[model samples]
Target: MNKWKIILDYFLKFLTALILIFLTLIIIFKFTIFNKNYIKNNLKENNYYEKVYDSIKENMENYIISSGFSENILDNIYTNKDVEIAINNYIDIIFSNKKDKIDLSKIENKINSNIDEYIKDQEIKILDKDSITSLVDDLLKIYTNEIELYNMFDNYINLFSKLQTILNIALICLLIITIILIIVLIKLKIQNLGIIPFTSSLMLLYIRFLIYNNIDYKNILIITDNFSNCLVQIVTKIVDLILICGIILGVMGLIAIILDSRKKNKKKE
Candidate 1:
């Protein structure tokens, strides 16, 4: 009876931990994927730079109606403030989704290398001291926030590649442990084997589904910092959940192994 109690207690722990892990997986789907779909559908498939361009155009149009542009004003001649705000949004939206994750160094190099020369050309085109001075003020603000902007992508890369990997190892170990525990309970004939593994198997299957279906980065563009931000968040969350669940299962496996070992030594006595 005491042995049966031990197995029942183990079954209870496995069920509770599995439930907690499952809930976190739901959070991953809701926050990372569902929200991404929501934003994409509402915004349409336009590039975020395109979106920012449209926003600035609309703002300029309203300004023109209320006021006016200078005679030499060029089309797309955004002020420093406009440029700063647009660039910031570009970074934000990109980082929000999780897809095609790469290391931060590589991503930053690709984006910065592509953009710097273009910005340099833009800098040379400014015709006056007022433009330069105003640009400096706006840029200072933009650069200060630049780290936060880059950090969104950085966090996602680590989360998806490293953190999720660790979690996956954990889940695998847990599942293995759970299996051993179950076999022990059964071999010992310690009452019911319980419903934990049945439910856990379902979760593992679903996680594999998300990982397979969510890799379409072509639909999403990482044209700016904002776009990078969105991509990292969504992708990392999904992968991380897979890892967390894997870890939980692995823990259960370890528990089973330990219990089995204890039971074996008792038999030897």
Candidate 2:
């Protein structure tokens, strides 16, 4: 065997060990060592979640006005054409921006504002102040409904985000193991033309990634945002999964090297 080959074999083993260490450390940080809240919180800080809060508030205000006119007004708040657009916008603001913590108080205030305008159309009848006061009291029910809706959305985002994180972690581990195994098998069977097809496929896969994506192999980023963005999010986690596997394969390449060395020695003996 070439002296250089021996050196390379040792290097490969060390490299695999290093990768495993990193994986272990990060896993540790994720579950035990690091601040568990930081991931979602960091997501929130990425952009001003306050903006989403404001938008929800605005939607609630619109809901109030439409509701006060008649219970039929709920149609405008949820089923009306504009309501769909507003809901979509709000989703983008929270999910697109990765912020699930929504503020319903802002929304309640918005509903009340819209209701205030509709109330203006009612002429003040001083003949019965009690009746006027009663109307105002009844209108507050709309605020309650708007707040409930906002809370529902908040719960949805929270659950969705947690699922996203768990999926990412699982994919990462799979990719790393896949890559290491592939690389090790590749080195061991270097002379087997039969395995060339697999290598070709791998090369093509790598080329596809390099050409289309520009993400770091290590220290990947998982960004979340409020629900206004149209871009799909699974891309980030999937790409990370692929890269993790690739790295593991690269690190585990030494198994093939060792096997090949033993074969050459046997032939000589």
List the global CA lDDT of all models.
0.50, 0.45
Candidate closest to the true structure, highest lDDT? 1
TM-score of predicted model 2? 0.32
lDDT of 1: 0.50
Cα lDDT tens digits, model 2, 200-257, are: 3344347438834665434333222243221122234334544554455443444555
Candidate 1, 1-269: lDDT as tens digits: 58877767676656644754555565455454544354454333334445445544454344334222221222434444444454545434444444432223433343334334544755645346575345334433333334234354554644444544555566566566656656665666653232354346456757666666877633455645445655665565567667666666656755665676677788899
Superposition error at 160 for model 1 (Å): 6.9
Candidate 2 wrongly placed segments (more than 4 Å): 1-42, 45-48, 67-225, 228-231, 254-269
TM-score of predicted structure 1:
0.35
